[model samples]
Target: MAQSVLHRDPRVDFFRGAAFIIILIAHIPSNWVAQWIPARFGFSDATEMFVFMSGFAAGIAFGGTYRTAGFWLGTARIYFRAWQVYVANLLLFFFVLVLMLAANAWLYADTDYVTQLALNYFLDDTGRALLGLFSMTYVPNFFDILPMYIVVLLMVPVFMALSRIHPLAGYAGCLVLYAANYVFIFELPAEVSPDRDFRAWFFNPFAWQLLFFTGFAMSMGYLKLPRFRWWLAALCLALIAVGVVYSRYGLWSWSDTLSDLRGQLVDLRCQNWRGDGADRCYFWTKSNLDVVRILHFLAIAYLVVWALKGRERVLTMGWAQPILQCGRQSLPVFMFSMILSRVYNVLMDQTERTTWEEIAFNVVAVANLIAIAYLLGWLKSNPWRPHKPARTPAPEAQGQAQGGARWGNAVPAPGSAE
Candidate 1:
């Protein structure tokens, strides 16, 4: 048997990096950039791509360790990663809170930053709110994504263990958990509230795990992607077109007829899933990873995968370098972007927000994000560490190397390990 080797996939990083940019733009309130994000064109947005790519990365990072190094070591690695994400969440929350407070105190803005973010829970009951924040029970909407991500990472170990028993077992578990979300109405509490307002996290881990693990399985070779065919491509494109027409942010919102048709179809789907009085469900819901959203995203993913197949070299081009770099350092970039979005929102509120100002703001914001990503990448590389120069071979050693090469020994020369 041969040991498996892992190679870096630019496709994963490219898409993930692109997702970070979209997320950053979308988070900022009333940013003109938001109107042009991919969410405006389809039912799904960058969130799906981000989560799926994360799962693929995890599979490459940890799944192989589980198979070769055994389950315990892999589980430990997953725990460490989850801890890192958890700490990042805490830092991001505190940093954003400080930013909001500063904006409130220093800027004469009409919007109450604290109230806008629904951070009153902390001010009203500091002790309880602290407990909930630490326990992940008092998640504000802005900070909910990381909590959901942490929970999903923690689930990887369970699936990895199940996979050892039977390849399909873990997949079954994913489906069961996804189904349980709708059937049993299972979701983690996001806030401690007397009323039902904002009860659960904006993204439900159980429902969303399906997308993550699908990527995981595909990356780990437990599942295979469908073969690309002309018919399949056409089907996916058609589905995406339907999504565009059905999407409120898309063509459907422009005309009453399309809007009514979408509503009726959505209501029918909702009734089929949850009985007649299902709170009048819409075509897309972010919190539970609605089926329509899942389908639309999958269709897009299939098409994109095929369209970009064997063209991964494009990701290495100069134009794509910024996105590639951001994807390589996605975690730090994400945390930075989260805080940066708040800063942008505050600045926008303080400024005139005219056409020219909005254009300048978006351009500067993107430049800042790219700059931070490159800075983080450099820091993470630890350039401050002392470099050890390559050792020069002695005359005898050089002679031996020459002799080995003459005899076809296949010995690698100094500084030529690769």
Candidate 2:
């Protein structure tokens, strides 16, 4: 990978930051704002965007290290990041659990918040659930993203090694794994149940890795995106329009009709499969990263690139700064948003679900995300480091320095002569 190819692009940050906001909205149940998110508009959503951007950023951040340093060093860095994400996941789960417990205790609400999150497994069998949680077995739906991410990060070195043999080799490996996901149905058990009724990780890393490595390959210069063209943009627009029409959230009057069509397709296609076939449309299976989602995301991503190509300056404008900053510190921002969404869900539950209340609550939630992004950025910058003022030379020293300059023996100030 060429170092030059790995330079930062502002558009990556812009889209990624925007996706974080969308994910926040989508996670909070009954938020009307979620209905208007891109997922509602199309097959793909922020989860795809998040995973793809993670791969792209990982390439930019670690690709050069693999090239300049040895393979072991690069692999070490990747695992260190995975460890960080693992810790964040644990922290988030416990914090949210505690929050819900406290709310349930004090609010006198009739909601069993733990059961709402499908965490009764933990309550019913703490020992088994704790073992499952740490071992990445009992991955609840809401908490699956980070576990998927951690597993993906661990696979980076494997792909990096394949890429060393040839770029095609790396992508071929990715495709094989992706296809094998369907053939083998490889997935982590999401429940710690003793019976045969077992659940699996929502975002299946084996299947989803195709998108991640696609972004990775592009970032590492193994794959190159075609420059924006008018005809291509038109095609992308047409695809997006089709996605909107076909999406479950589209066409209020056709919702039931579309639902039936999807159900028919799932029954026709998935029921006969040798492995476990989920009772839903395989074409829109978020867990499987179906082709429909892949194509939809590609179309949306290309059109976005076309829209931003000559107008890159817009990302640096006043209103875009908060989003850009959130992208820059995405891990912290995403973690904070996850924690914040729980509070928003609790508050929204108490409200009448009016338009004004929804708008107000969502606005406050976004504001909180932006504030945390900036705060985390500042903290990561090591702002508490002591600063030393430059010392002024004494009168005699100044005179000697002046004499040395005249006599061609003066040393230049640091970076002054560059």
Candidate 3:
């Protein structure tokens, strides 16, 4: 019998949506409401979850695409998608840059607008415009992930080729790269300049590639490691325990002997810290592979998969569908959410409240996010129902293309399907 795969994994969608929520909460300026939940619970940094899922989703999306479309066509599709992301990012950069300039001029007339403009050079129209067009590293902006995505897309051909020939060797290559990254790249001093002077150190593709390639390998059944659902549960518990210990008593030090050795090897400053054994708990938060974090996330992810197996109804209930929809079209949703977040930040800055009001602010923020998400969902469902332009296709089309024919067919056609 042919092996089966899930077209829409509720667990993945729920976790992805939850990740976005956490990211939103984290970005909310410190308020009493936000602080009520302890940061250690994983609310402080949701970026790791997002990035990891991005890789995981990439595996599910592109790996399937490669199988169906074959290597060359699959590579082209990925490149096109990456290029679309880059283009969208570029447009956003210019839009934000212009707004920032106008705000500086009109809003901060008394202050040194020129100085402010210069300081935000990367956020300026010309700088962002250049970065977007060329995919060059011009600024230390969080939005620069577009370039990284593009670079990773470029690697798809190589990854695909290796996967076709020897999936184990391909995955092993990814593992070796990850190991080298951990020992040499990640261990290097924080300030070590990449050849591009682009803080490639911070955005270490080598390390992140492991997550992406692992997803790819899994999709291809290259690494036939036993699927230990129960062990995954244990791993999750262990990670929680480690996180709790680290948060409570782990000491953070950047001057340890290990740091010195690492710093010397890489010719950069080293930050070494002693965690209460739990301090270094969340690997995703590190944005680099920490063995503990990697193992923990893997465990949690597998457990989630096991739990959600054959449970489709759980994903179809009440608000769950919309959230899953958001997860399905994650890239666009992410881009849209980022734009909304930046707008929210600007609005919050304008308000300038000193006190953190948790209940009130969170209530408003959550409501707005959900409302926006719902609106986006509605648009997705009914893109051409007379009011909206038929020009832009529903985000579901994008997901379908990535997932292949079966899943693609599941998406209701514009008017009749939903």
lDDT of candidate 2 over 1-418, digit per residue (tens): 1221222356667777898898888888878888788888887889889888777767666665576566898888888888989999999999999998877887755667888898877888899999999999888888999999999889999998998899768888999999888776787898887963878899899999999988777766777777768898888888798778777754634778767876675567556455455543452478999877888898888877667766777877998999987887878788888888888988887878798898899999999999998988788767789866745532223322221122122222211110
- Model 1 has an lDDT value of 0.77
> Residue 300, candidate 3: how far off, in angstroms?
2.3
Off by over 4 Å in 2: 1-8, 250-284, 386-418
lDDT of 3 by residue, 38-114 (tens): 34542123455666566556665566556656778778877877777777767766665566566666663343423
| Residue pair clashes in candidate 1 | none
What TM-score, over all chains together, does every model reach? 0.88, 0.86, 0.70
CA shift at 238, candidate 1, in angstroms? 0.3
- RMSD in Å for candidate 1, one decimal? 7.9
| Global lDDT of model 2 | 0.76
Candidate 1, residues 355-399, lDDT tens digits: the string is 778878878887899899899878866799987774454332332
Alpha-carbon lDDT, every model: 0.77, 0.76, 0.53
Model 2: pairs clashing at backbone N, Cα or C within 3 Å: none
Candidate 1, position 34, lDDT: 86
